[model samples]
Target: MSSSPEKFSKNAVIVNELGLHARSAAKIAEIARTAKSKIWVIRDGEKADAASIIDMLALACSKGTRVTISADYSEDIEILNRIKALIQNGFGE
Candidate 1:
């Protein structure tokens, strides 16, 4: 079987009111890890490993800041959708 790789993206929200705080970072981190594909977050031209919760929180995603989330993978549209939903849903905090 052949699996084609594709990318899906959306801006991560700065919804914590106090910005992307620990709780919000943790949520994004959790979702990123759950996916089979690699997720990367880039800010100010700098990139961080999305799977590490600590790294994410360190970005200090302030309130109203936008982070681009890109995913690359195959045979996992469902996972992609979930990730998208989590971002769209603002991590359900």
Candidate 2:
């Protein structure tokens, strides 16, 4: 029997003045796309595909919004951390 892969996640707050807008979402998606497993961004009970810019934008996360960045597999932990850092750093805005 095979067991599910370990999941990795981190929490971060949107610190950018503009929040998670198109550019920031795009940046996240870019990193997410490199993950070997699925990446998810969740906010206020709403989940968005980290690889989908539109899905992220739909979350409408504004400044100070808290979000969870998760990876379906432990192998993608670096991807999770990169995204978390990006959000925590205000997307470098």
What TM-score, to 2 decimals, does candidate 2 have?
A: 0.91
Model 1 misplaced regions, further than 4 Å: 1-7, 74-80
Question: Which tens-of-lDDT digit does each residue in 1-93 have in candidate 1?
Answer: 123222455555555466666776677677778877677666665666677767777787786677776666653455556655765566676
Candidate 1 CA-lDDT value: 0.65
TM-score of each: 0.70, 0.91
Please give the clash total of every predicted structure, in order: 0, 0
lDDT of 2 by residue, 1-93 (tens): 123323477889999999899999999999999999889899977889999999999999999999888777788888888998888888888
Assess each prediction's global lDDT (C-alpha) against the native.
Answer: 0.65, 0.88
Candidate 1 clashes between residue pairs 3 or more apart in a chain or in different chains? none
RMSD of each: 4.0, 2.7
Error of 1 at 3 (Å): 14
